[model samples]
Target: MKKLSFLFIIFILIHSSVSAIDRRTEQFSTEFGYLTLPLPYVIPGAGMGLGFLGGFNNVPFGST
Candidate 1:
């Protein structure tokens, strides 16, 4: 696991450095909501999950 994590980090570093990123980004973590009104497939009030558009990989060129 440690080796995998290390390699992943290295890969991300190389990839980020090789590419460019725009500074524009959404600042808030929006909660994903579904309208399950009288739906047979989905239960009422059953939250599916959070809409986590993970910005961890959104590192700019200088950040790496």
Candidate 2:
């Protein structure tokens, strides 16, 4: 679990740096943004669980 967490953090850092570069090289647009939705629920016997739905809108470079 610890190793997984560490890797996830590293991945996020690298991805953020790449995204920053992409944003810098692109034309400024008001439609670019991200959304995150959290979902929490309970089950009859399985206890509780949480989930997230996230995405970026109008990504630069015509990429979805």
lDDT of each: 0.60, 0.84
- In terms of TM-score, which candidate is strongest? 2
- Taking all chains together, the TM-score of candidate 1 against the true structure is 0.30
**Model 1 regions more than 4 Å off:** 20-64
Give the alpha carbon lDDT tens digit for every residue of 1-64 in model 2: 9999999999999998887444655485657799999989999999999999899976678655
Query: What is the lDDT for 21 in model 2?
Result: 42
lDDT value, residue 48 of candidate 2: 100
Prediction 1 global C-alpha lDDT: 0.60
Error of 1 at 23 (Å): 13
The residue-by-residue lDDT of candidate 1 on 1-64, one tens digit each, is 9999999999999999999677686765344444433333444698454343322433344522
